[model samples]
Target chain A: MKNTIETSDRPVTITIPEPEYPLHTLSVLVNNKPGVLARIAQVFSRRGYNIESLVVSPAAEMDFSRMTIGARGEESGLDQIKAQCNKLIDVISCYDHTDDAVVSKELALVKISVGASSRGEALQIAEHFGCKTLDLAPESLVFMVTGDSGKLDAMVGMMQKFGIVELVRTGKVVMTRGNGLT
Target chain B: MNAEPRDGAQTLLKCLEAGGIEVMFGYSGGAALPIFDALETAGTKIKFVLARHEQGATHMADGYARATGKPACVLVTSGPGAGNTITGIMTAHMDSVPMVIISGQQVTWMLGKDAFQEADIFGITMPIVKHSYLVKDAADIPRVTKEAIYLATSGRPGPVLIDMPKNISQGPCDAPLDAEIDLPGYNPEKAYEIDSKDVEAVAAALAKSERPLILAGHGAMLAHAGPELKELAETARIPVCNTLLGKGIFDETHELALGMLGMHGTAYANKAVCEADLIFNIGSRFDDRIIGQPDKFGKNATIIHVDIDPSEMGKMIQPDLKIVGDAKVVLAELNKHIKALPTESWLATLDGYKKRFPLSYKIQGGLKMQHVLDVWDRLTESNSIVATDVGQHQMWSAQFNKSKAPWNWISSGGAGTMGFGFPAAIGAQLGRPDDVVIAVVGDGGFQMTLCELATAVLQKLPLKILVLNNHFLGMVRQWQELFFDNRTSGVDLEGNPDFVKLAEAYGAKGFQIKRPADIEKVLTRALEYTDGPCLINCEVVKEDNVFPMIPAGAALEDMITEKPKHRMEKPTGST
Candidate 1:
């Protein structure tokens, strides 16, 4: 075997990944007011930015609101918007998570067509994705899955190959990875 | 009563007076002649403002209602006279203004025989009015009159109608004068409460989530929850987005402001909304315009919906936590329970997006409409009220005009009415005399109610008219270019008369602007003139269109950013 091996052989190659656009998760603190949202929306509207998943509620200890905004944009523009928001009397603060650590997850409910023939495969897939069968009919099955948006989307794509009837998704909900409350 | 004096017409006038109606705008007609004659002879307390047109009369009454927050009454005769008030009635309905329109009908004997100058006025106005009543007997007159006023001024105010037969106005019985009418299932002061369990669930979710988005709608405006919404967003470090109807609810100048979200939303705002991790909807019904496709919307986030209307919750998109309550109350309680969260990274990301795709419009190397808006912005005070007719100009004003306070911007939102601004401006101006009033109308829209100039002159109202004359119905032309393959339909006004002459005819001064240089000076002159009403028609290029347009039914991201390449295709002869 050694005598038959070639002298020169190609090395198994592993390419280094290129630098990517920074992903950021932001928590926007604002006043719950009419037109306040419009004003905030105008900032994104005029600029043509895309928001990922957003969650809003009032803070635990104040008379203000909390908005969790996920988005991908250049660093400078995001900074300008944050600064602008901070200048508003109603805006308490804005936190960007691109440079900070955060935890985020998304939830989805999918209704898929599962005939008797595909029932076993559908159940198997649902079990693998940690999804619960919320509604199980003779002809169809509805599964509820909670996870990151990407994970849910992947599961949905896998299920789509069989047959999808309808789907409902809750956008992403996020939190900081650390214990910093402010 | 001395011998129980019984004149049918006089009795009707007395009933109207008893109903607490101080004034009425109307025109005389055949079937209504007796009522008018009785009004003249009885010397009733009610004053009358005779209108040249029935439409004008209705609008005057509408103006009175919007001004006083009371149901203003209008009187019209049978047949076409009653029909003429339809446009004004529709206007009031669309804007949710309160008005009571009374129409005289043929005598009770000839009610349904298709008599001359007779019409099924009640049936015709049914869809347009909140309620319509047909007076069959003289005994029902007093009760109907009071009920009509009450219904018109009640919850979510709108127009109400009372059709008076000629004989009913004359025939008499014991006056049905009482302040009470039992209306079942009409709860004007209904209050909604949030479920405690749902509030706790939402609080827990907020405590855990890092990135959140708040979407506010017109319901917040109606609820007067702007302050609470602002407080919640700020304290929680959440970004906010708004729908078109909710434009002024949040201050646009806020840093966390994502601008308007929907088909016509700014690119940044749409992107932010689409990419948000959690979407909390407040006082908004997630209209299709706001959400492009439910499957594609908030694809990566949990949606928390809070609304006063339970039916609205989870109707469009299911929420992780559905809190049914008034926005103000829910926001207040949520604020008390949620701790402050860090959103520096989120703010930084939004800021970057804001800079990369700023809201920009082109000038076309000529007189820019921005200049006109800028001039108005400078001259008008914060208290100065502004109304706009539906078109590119209205959007432009919405985009440019900085309203520092509430109720300063009044326009037909859902209806997108073209001829609304002229009459509405008159009404708003009349309502708030001390506040400066300006109506920004397009040339096409202005001509629709150009007759109202006479009303302004007659009333001696110092209303200012800023007509952005592009010689076309700008919005329709834009649509034609975008959707109709550039076939400019009936949208141009090339052969129209000089507006200055028209204004002079109505005893008002008019200023015309064609060149870019004249805008500021003309606006200054128009604003300075404290005399009678003045019109400043800025003759902009005929083909210019508003940019950053969201095509109908498209996602907010698919906005038209620059000027369209098509240029009128040589003005298809005689529009």
Candidate 2:
């Protein structure tokens, strides 16, 4: 099995082994001031941790921004990152969302070319996976999908049989479920 | 509500008066000229303590804050002045000293356009300060000043920067100067509330423990929790071992007082920590120097940590239980439920360790550093506030000079900044005018900020400076001799300036002591010279090293007390 970018479609095959470096998702609240994001990023860069994925948006508060960061590192390294992040002045709070105590989602838009022969199969796959038809052209169709990052990846793989054209993905956003961490 | 309009400088002076800032340490520059003029003209009653360098001013503010437990304001000009304050701010940040630093910036119109003497001080000090504000409006002075003082002096106290633009200080405003603070995101007091459950848990642990030890840190001093801590220790009959910054927080002369515990700590203190059945770490971060090997530190103990900052918990060693609150509040609460427990047998065992491994040095040498410190300690008695620079002399001072009162021992413990002693001593003297303030610095560290001598002379501060002239960076030289095959690289000060002559040039009385016989006489004279600052240059054996040192990453039990070549047989202890 190969894990590579899906090119030329044909249901690109992929396999992922057990991760030695576990994935950690962290939700950080920070002041919505200039240079804060760069400061937060530098903290990770200085500590030698690569951010796997990041999504930042204004939080419920007027002057605060919430950032969701997904990174892969050893458990101890991840803990160190959390501790260092907490030390930053702009950072109001940093909560680790790796546990199942939170709800998370990632959005992806996949544009795939659908010939008449594969049109039926493509529509059937989209319908089965609950992917929304964002735009439908005679030859190519764009479907917007929202789910956990893994589920979105699976959807992208299944849609690859129709000859994928262009794909864009928004990382992930997370929040604790049911009146948890405020 | 109709207050007269005033310029930015007058407004800032008014705010300073409102904040109850009696004195501020600073050096004036172009950007700060308006504020200085206002200070002179407005008669706001905020006395200015001038410093030779901006760095010296910052250290003065830091020492003042550390000594008084109040926020000391620092005023400096743009780029160079702000840049010079980095070391002082970092030192304050590391030790949680309360300071408010006001750096003058280029006018708001000239910002980001490469104006002369302009600096992005707010951005530069973001990591070093607890908080910072870039004030563009003169009307914001009262509010910003109030916030800065509050943040600097509140829970987990640290330095805060306020970048006041030149235009802001020159502008006029009629805004009512109300010192009301309204920071929604900043809440330092919530998490630090005393929890009854944690107190009960701590009380229960103390009751069951056979050998419980209390490890105190800087927070205890910052919180003024010494009396409460002493009460708790006496009630529970727990022996207290202090981190370097926590030295004066407990009475060092007390029988239960195990001296400082760290790399250069006393052997008995570290041994007690290692052998304790339960450890109560109060307000200490468990710095790497203190806990050389985290896993091996207190291997037999169930550690319980109490601190104001929640982030510090489980940072070095995972404690069996943790509590987040100010040391004073938490200790006061815990003491209410604590009854005097029987710790006689356990304390007796530690007493044996203390008696067996007392911190000692060879007295036959020519002007040994220890003897100088012993003489200084005897001459000064317990009434003196001793501030030391980072090096062998610092450890020696900590070992020899017994601090009898809280906030009496000041040193750059967390950042370990060299050259912090002289300026800090000046600040301490200014802060506590009635007390004797002595700075015991190594020759190497003394040279780092020796220019502050002029500031001391000019201010007519009665600061006593003792330069332990070892002619080398003794700590580094010792480490080189032990670990680096005796390869002395940059540690030697070959042709250092004559500190006595140098002090004389700075308008200070200079005293030189070479023979061990003259240590007392010179120290006495220097102490007697209350007219202005005095510098005592004591020439001593150059190769002397601090002892009971836990080699980096080595367990506290593995201390090197003597020269490696002629070391005594190792004593076996429980690991």
- Candidates' lDDT values, in order? 0.72, 0.85
**Model 1 chain A weakest lDDT span, ten residues long:** A1-10
User: Which segments of candidate 1 are over 4 A away from where they belong?
Assistant: A1-182, B1-28, B32-52, B56-71, B192-211, B237-240, B254-259, B278-289, B292-341, B362-364, B381-383, B563-575
- For B1-575, candidate 2 gives per-residue lDDT tens digits of 57665888888888877887877999889898888889887778887988888888988988887788777889999999989999999999999998989898899999999899988888888778887888877878888888888888887889989998988887786777775786655667774677799889989999999999999998888778998999999888999999988988998889999989988898889889888999999989999889988889998999999888766877788999888888888898888889888899999999999889998887777888899888888887766999899999999999999877888888998889998998999899899998889999999888888889988898898889999998999998887777667789999899989888999998999999999889888888888899999999989998877888887778888777766675333322311
Q: Which candidate is the best by TM-score?
A: 2
lDDT of 1 by residue, A1-182 (tens): 11111111222222223324455677777766433454555555545556655677787745667787776566656765664444333466677765656677777888777678888998999999999999989878899999987799788877765566676776766677769643
Share of true Cα-Cα contacts across chains kept by each model: 0.00, 0.15
Q: After superposition, how far is residue A121 of candidate 2 from its true place, in Å?
A: 7.0
* Superposition error at B27 for model 1 (Å): 4.2
How many collisions per candidate?
123, 0
Worst 10 residues of 2 chain A by lDDT: A9-18
